[model samples]
Target chain A: LAKTTQPISMDSYEGQEVNITCSHNNIATNDYITWYQQFPSQGPRFIIQGYKTKVTNEVASLFIPADRKSSTLSLPRVSLSDTAVYYCLVGIMDSSYKLIFGSGTRLLVRP
Target chain B: EPEVTQTPSHQVTQMGQEVILRCVPISNHLYFYWYRQILGQKVEFLVSFYNNEISEKSEIFDDQFSVERPDGSNFTLKIRSTKLEDSAMYFCASSEEDISGELFFGEGSRLTVL
Candidate 1:
């Protein structure tokens, strides 16, 4: 499993866009980048995943540069309710048995 | 939007007692997993189950820990004898058979061991 690093915490005002980046310099060839959001006392929900380049969903967008060593999760017009801890994981999709989670980025969307 | 579901949102147990956590994964999901998070700590994987047996397990899953898919719809984790140190939030997750590793997590079960 590749290790990931992200900001410990961040603050954003309501209605503003937020971008959180993750670095995984040793990401493996079969690794797929995935992001998850977890509200207090709730489960971590899958936000987006990508192999390379970019991937977008109804909730968020993921941008990966050619290096594939890093990626960013972009949330548009975030609201106070969007405040949550965000986790970035890199592993083989549908192929790996192990998934390691780091301390995650605590995003505070202040109103 | 089928989601994974876990029962007993909260559990308070005494040390040396047995406890079982239950989960009902998405109907179509084929791989199941268990993870635990102590207060203010990172999430840790305990075990993964596939094809009627364990696919992988972390060191944290010890001899006292066991997992079973007793029925088609229910997955369970049983701790033979709980310890105070076992206090933590336990989460269950599942994914499609293809192994894309995009696991969908259930709202954890908070286990409070005293």
Candidate 2:
């Protein structure tokens, strides 16, 4: 398991882009970067995942640099409904792998 | 979209009582997991199950905790003795495959141990 660091909170307004960065300096070669989102009283939902470079999906994009020490989750045109806690996890993708979540970054999408 | 489902959206129990939480994973999924979150705290992994057995479990999953797949569609977690510290939201999740697949989580079963 790779320890991850992220901002405690971030503020954003509707229609603006939000980028949350996570630092995993000790990430291993087999580790993949995954991001999950959790709304109030809801289970965490998978947003995006990437091994390197960039990966885009219907909801968000993940950008990982070559060094793999850090990654960013970019949400385009944020809305009030997007307010949630974002968790960044780094781990091996194996049968025995389990996600260890940290205190996630709370994104406050203001009206 | 296929989603995981959990029973007894919320449960309140006395200390030292036994409790069982049930889940119905996605139809095609092969991996199942249990995670808990204390109020205002990070999500913690409890255990993962595959091929009818446990593949991994965290230290939080002590002797008091157990998991079972009684049939084809249902998965369950049992707490033999509940403590006040056991109060938290327990989430059940499943994945189509064990390697590089996204997990689908349920709404969660909130346990309040008194």
Candidate 3:
């Protein structure tokens, strides 16, 4: 399991793009970067995942540099409802038993 | 989209009492997991189940905790003796494969021990 570091909190305006970066300097070669969003009192929901480079989905995009020491989660045109705690996890895909969630970045999408 | 479902959205129990939290995973999913979050704290992994048995468990999953898949669709977590420290929101989740993809999680079962 790779330990991750992220901002404790961030403020973003509605309709603006938000990017949360996570650092996993000790990330292993088999590790994949995964981001999950959790709303108040709700379980963490998967937002995006990528092994390397960039991967885009309907909800968000993940960008991993070649070094793989860090990754970024980009949310486009954010709304107030997008405010939530975002968790970045690094673990082996299909082999790891459980996801180790660290204190995540809390994004506040303000109007 | 298929989702995981948990029963008794909230539970209140006394110390030393046993409680069982139930979950119904997505119909086609093969992997199940249990996680808990103490109020104002980070989410912690308790255990993961696959092929009708436990694949991994955390240190938090002590002797007091156990997991079972009694039938085809239901996965359950049992706490033999509750403590005040056991109070937290218990979340059940399932994945189509292993960690290769996203996990579908239930709302959660909030357990309060007195």
Candidate 4:
């Protein structure tokens, strides 16, 4: 498992685009970067995932560089409901898919 | 969208008492997992189950903790004897083979040990 680092907190206004970046310098070739959003009292929800380049979904987008050492989660047209803790995980598809979590970035989308 | 569901959204138990958290994962999913989060702390993985057995578990999953897929639809986590430190929010998750690493989590069961 590769360790990840992200901002402790970020503030964004509604209708603005928010980008949260995570760094994993030791990311392996087989490792995939995944982002999860967690709201208060709720479980973590998968937002987006990517190996390299960019991956987009109905909810968010993920961008990875050539080095694969870092990734960013972009949320477009944020709303207050989007305020949550965003976790960045790096993992491989091993026999067991256990996700290691860190002190994710707490994104606050203000109205 | 199919989602994971957990029972007894909140549970309160006395120290040394046995407690069970129940979960019903997505119908088509094959893998199940349990995670816990202490107040104001990061979420921690506890165990993963597949093929009617535990595939992996973390150090936090001590001898007192156990998981069982008793039926076709229900997966359960049982703590033999609860302790104060065991009080936390326990989340149940599932993922399919096609999207192995993409997990769908439940709302979580908040356990309080007194």
Best by lDDT: 2
**Between 1 and 2, whose TM-score is larger?**
2
Candidate maximizing DockQ: 2
The lDDT for every candidate, in the order shown, is: 0.87, 0.89, 0.87, 0.87
- Angstrom error of the Cα, residue B84, model 1: value is 1.4
Model 2 alpha-carbon drift over 4 Å, by segment: A26-28, A92-97
Give the fraction of native contacts in model 3.
0.52
Q: Per-residue CA lDDT of candidate 3, range A3-32, in tens?
A: 668989999999999999988777656657
Candidate 1 clashing pairs?
A93-B99, A93-B100, A94-B99, A94-B100, A94-B101, A95-B99
Off by over 4 Å in 3: A26-28, A92-97
Score residue A104 of candidate 2 by CA lDDT: 90
Model 3 complex DockQ against the native: 0.56
RMSD of each: 2.5, 2.2, 2.3, 2.4
Q: What is the TM-score of each candidate against the true structure?
A: 0.91, 0.92, 0.92, 0.91
All candidates: DockQ:
0.58, 0.60, 0.56, 0.57
Error of 4 at A23 (Å): 2.5
Q: List ranges where model 1 is wrong by over 4 Å.
A: A92-97
Across residues A6-81, which tens digit of lDDT does each residue of candidate 2 receive?
A: 8999999999999999887776567678899999899999999898999999999999999998899999999999
> What does candidate 2's lDDT look like per residue over B24-105, in tens digits?
9999999999999999988888998999999889879999999999999999999999999999999999987665547889
lDDT of 1 by residue, A1-111 (tens): 346689999999999999999887776677688898888788888889998998998989999999898889999999989989998866522334466665589999888
